[model samples]
Target: MKDLIFDNFQNAVDESLLRHKSILDIITKLQESEGRINRAVAKSVTNCGCIRVDAKKQELPKEDDDIEQLSNALKTHIEGKLCDSCREVIEHEIGNNLFYLTSLCNALDLNLYDIFIKEYDKINTLGRYTLR
Candidate 1:
């Protein structure tokens, strides 16, 4: 198989860590990075919601119409260049999500990576329990 490629924002964020000034720098950098990633996710969600509203605005009744509303909304958003409102929505949405996750991690004494690994191993190993 050909070499795999990652063309996503998350990949870019991960790759950026190598260029940091020092290992100590990574701690601060990581906090900033996660905030940014969560923000980006939020914006995309907001854009999707806006698209949905726009699609609903454009709806017309027809006999036996069975198309998914959100899918149609997405098409409308893309075609209409609905970015300004979507951008605001994304910023607010991402900010809130990032804030909550950061707060929860701080309060709960959780290591996201460790938790993720434990869950993933359980998923893969089906009834086999392993000591961490």
Candidate 2:
């Protein structure tokens, strides 16, 4: 059922994508979409003032601390949540990123769902060790 959704999205992208059909075009567009996402987030912080980023060097857990403690010690440095307008813009940009990502997979004759499953299986099998 989940695979069906991913397959349909890939098919939709393949069918609707007419201008940027070339692999090179798709790759560059994919890169552009990533930048757009970053810009949207930045706008939310700078323009909308809905969120604030207070990023700094991360402090590590004690040497004797467990993996769970390390996880708990980490921070995203983002305060508050995205407002509706900022959230919508970010979601749209991310969708564009996925479209090009699927296009790249299509051009390379790869199954997007299979790639997802492979990653999922690897993470599931590796658990916390997958971080490395």
Candidate 3:
């Protein structure tokens, strides 16, 4: 109903989170949401057969290769795109995950945007080393 802005969504989650106010509840719900997301993705590959995971050992680059080279050589192991049904299910599960994540941040008096910015800065600072 509202804009998908981070702070706005965080505030909305804070406002709507009436039942799971306790930190413990929020944490468990968050974990559950994560599990659901995993299940949804699994179903897409296993049941729906919309996508596939050709999971195998990552073909590591040469020892002397640059970080950029290593990054370029990496593979996600996921082949094929998610179908509309699978995408919708996964998106909904991820939305639930975000809801509880925002709830945890709210309970701890932390700003979701601040967390994002801090992580963004860390990644930017450690562009080459962050992989490790």
Candidate 4:
């Protein structure tokens, strides 16, 4: 057996670290943007009592099995309530964000859940509070 070593190994590791940091920065920006979007959506839906009425009509299941069905129904109702332009804009922004996120994950050989956990830990360590 022969021992083989690459001269640029340090450079490769440093580059990977840089990429990881960049990904983290992107995640932070995305988190902030998501908070803003959520606030705006909540404000917009405040006056629309129909969502509450519909939600109240449904008999929410106690078991976890029907959670997905309930989630889909709520999402559909919210989308229906959004104006066409608002819906299109929201969908487009989400699609673009996901595209970049997946691409970064692929390049870094990481999954979204892992990245989210890492970011969450970082935030907690920094004494920041996260909603989730």
Clashing pairs in 2: none
If ranked by lDDT, best first, what sequence of candidates would result?
A: 2, 3, 4, 1
RMSD of each: 12.3, 0.9, 2.5, 12.3
Span of 10 residues, lowest total lDDT, candidate 1: 1-10
Give the alpha carbon lDDT tens digit for every residue of 1-132 in model 3. Answer: 222488788888998999999999999999999999999999999999999999888888999999888988888989999999999999999999999999999999998888888888999998879886
lDDT by candidate, in order shown: 0.47, 0.95, 0.92, 0.51
Quick one: best lDDT, which candidate? 2
Better candidate number, 1 or 3, judged by TM-score: 3
Error of 3 at 84 (Å): 0.7
Query: Which residues of candidate 2, in runs, are more than 4 Å off?
Result: none
- lDDT by residue for model 2 (80-111), tens: 99999999999999999999999999999999
Model 4 lDDT per residue over 1-132, tens place: 111122133234335444345776657645755665565455446644222222345455456655466554442334336656555555766654554455456457665555666886787886423422
TM-score comparison, 2 vs 3, better candidate: 2
lDDT of 1 by residue, 18-92 (tens): 444354454555566566766554455564543322334555446465444433433333333336766665566
The alpha-carbon lDDT assigned to residue 90 of candidate 4 equals 58
Model 3 clashing-pair count: 0
How does model 3 fare in lDDT? 0.92
lDDT of 4 at 101: 55
Q: Which pairs clash inside model 1? A: 43-90
Each prediction's TM-score versus the true structure: 0.29, 0.97, 0.92, 0.39
